[model samples]
Target: MKRLLTAALLTLSIAAPNAFAGDTRLELPLQDLIDSPQAKEAGIDGSVRFYLSGQAHPAVVSRMGEDVSNKKTNGVGKSDVESCRWVALSVLKAFQESAKARGANAVVDITSYFKKNEFKSPTNYECYAGNIMSGVALKGTYAKVK
Candidate 1:
């Protein structure tokens, strides 16, 4: 019986190697997520503004440090875009709080830092959607801007 079960499992693995792989790459507009009402709900009221990669910002007064946020996916029955935005909101909120804590007024040079890979886009962000979850990762430089 054990041998038969092992043989069946082996066959299944061979038949569908990608059955459990769920990686959907999406690049969605960045401004929409930043402007969403949920940002207010997250307490990100523009006190600590964000500037995406290649976007212009006021002269940086001081560089506090780098910031990163890797939010877990909470996507169930939601579209990839919706799920991505929600996770991105949470990430940005954290950044805002961090900037505030460190006396920084902005986070600039934001980019997608998924899997430690940097994906920079001036107008969009990259998200990975899976079967049961989606994730948004961000990296930025904390700064006190003019």
Candidate 2:
């Protein structure tokens, strides 16, 4: 009976998960880097292009940022990376919307800041203790890469 009750409790725990996260939409200045005219000329009207830090680009139009944190209470035995990936995706979506609105062809110099990313921060242990993962802060420069 004890084992059955324990199993039922575990099942209940796995059924419900909770987390606290946030989203930020930013308006960056990428006018000179890839203006509408320039973007149109370069055929860079969409968000398909991306350039990381080391990649070369014509110019920097603006800077954009988005931060997201995710947690899974039921994910005690699950993969943290997987849980964090969802948060990353949320950040990416935010980035995409802002970039598209600003007519940016790509996001450059993208960086990731995760919760529990390093031992120096309390989030690392807090995430483990609370069965929560947080902070997928992604910031980047918006530019035309064509």
What's the lDDT of the predicted structure labeled candidate 1? 0.86
Query: For candidate 1, lDDT tens digit of each residue in 5-115?
Result: 999999988855443233788998878877888778877798989999899889998999997899966677889888888888888888988999999999999999998
Worst 10 residues of 1 by lDDT: 14-23
- Candidate 2 residue lDDT tens string, 28-129: 223232333544444444454544345456565555443233323333454554444334445545656667777766776654333424222211211232
Instruction: Estimate the overall C-alpha local distance difference test score of candidate 2.
Output: 0.45
lDDT of 2 at 13: 82
Residue 135 of model 1 has an lDDT of 87
Q: List the residue pairs that clash in candidate 1.
A: none
The superposed Cα distance between candidate 1 and the true structure at residue 56, in angstroms, equals 0.8
TM-scores for candidates 1 onward, in order? 0.84, 0.44
- Global lDDT of each model? 0.86, 0.45
